[model samples]
Target: MGIKRTVLIDEPFPDLFCGLCQGEFWEIDFIPVLVPHFVFLLLLLLEILDDPVQVRCPEDHMFCSSCIGNYLQQSRTCPHCLTDLDPSLFQPSKFVQRQIGRLRVRCPYHEAGCTWQGILSDSHPNEDR
Candidate 1:
């Protein structure tokens, strides 16, 4: 609960994108403004990452747990560096998870007329979405 600020979607934040799907690592509360068409497409593809995991590489690349798990089953190598990977060594990225949890996002039903927007982790299933 620091400064409650909103981020414009015009600038790209590389760390916010998932390595596997190239989609946003978390949904964001978008401001109503005139943005480029591509930005809208990117927003449309936004998804709340499930079980974010960090790869055991120097770069510490991250991917959704399911994505990395499935990829490892096919090839036991880091997707970014092609280095040998040990599935057992993979661990949930608690730091990244916390960061994502702090993000502000509109309700999943925002497009369906829900105006609720707040901290992602604070959103509850019983919300009036």
Candidate 2:
């Protein structure tokens, strides 16, 4: 067999929040972190298979709960990757918890020279509460 990509789907999506700065996504903005769309799709599939269905933002840049709830009631597919969303497949689980919680990861833009890491929950700080 050829060499395999070992990128873990189980790992949490990187958070963009900064607890130290108490900043939001744009506020703590660094360089652009480019994730190939295909890779993002792969990760989303692995995540949704585990618990309640997840949705993407209108810009197709991030995942959101309320956005998904609203979108699913009208459409059965993700606005971003067009992944089919089956509400029947949604089963709420206490296991449903933020993967990174309040931690940070190398900025997706680390491929360049921007050294920044923050909370993933910071993606859409003004959405829920």
lDDT of all predictions: 0.54, 0.34
Q: Among all windows of ten consecutive residues in candidate 1, which has the lowest summed lDDT?
A: 36-45
Query: What is the per-residue lDDT of model 2 for residues 11-111, given as tens digits with 9 covering 90 to 100?
Result: 33332111112112221223445443222211322222122233333432333344456555777776655676655554332233343333233444444
Steric clash pairs (candidate 2): 15-119, 15-120, 16-119, 16-120, 17-119
Residue 15 in candidate 2, Cα distance off native in Å: 8.1
lDDT of 2 at 41: 17
Worst 10 residues of 2 by lDDT: 1-10
- Candidate 2, overall lDDT? 0.34
lDDT by residue (tens digit), candidate 1, 49-112:
4467777877676777876777777898887789888777787877666666665455566556
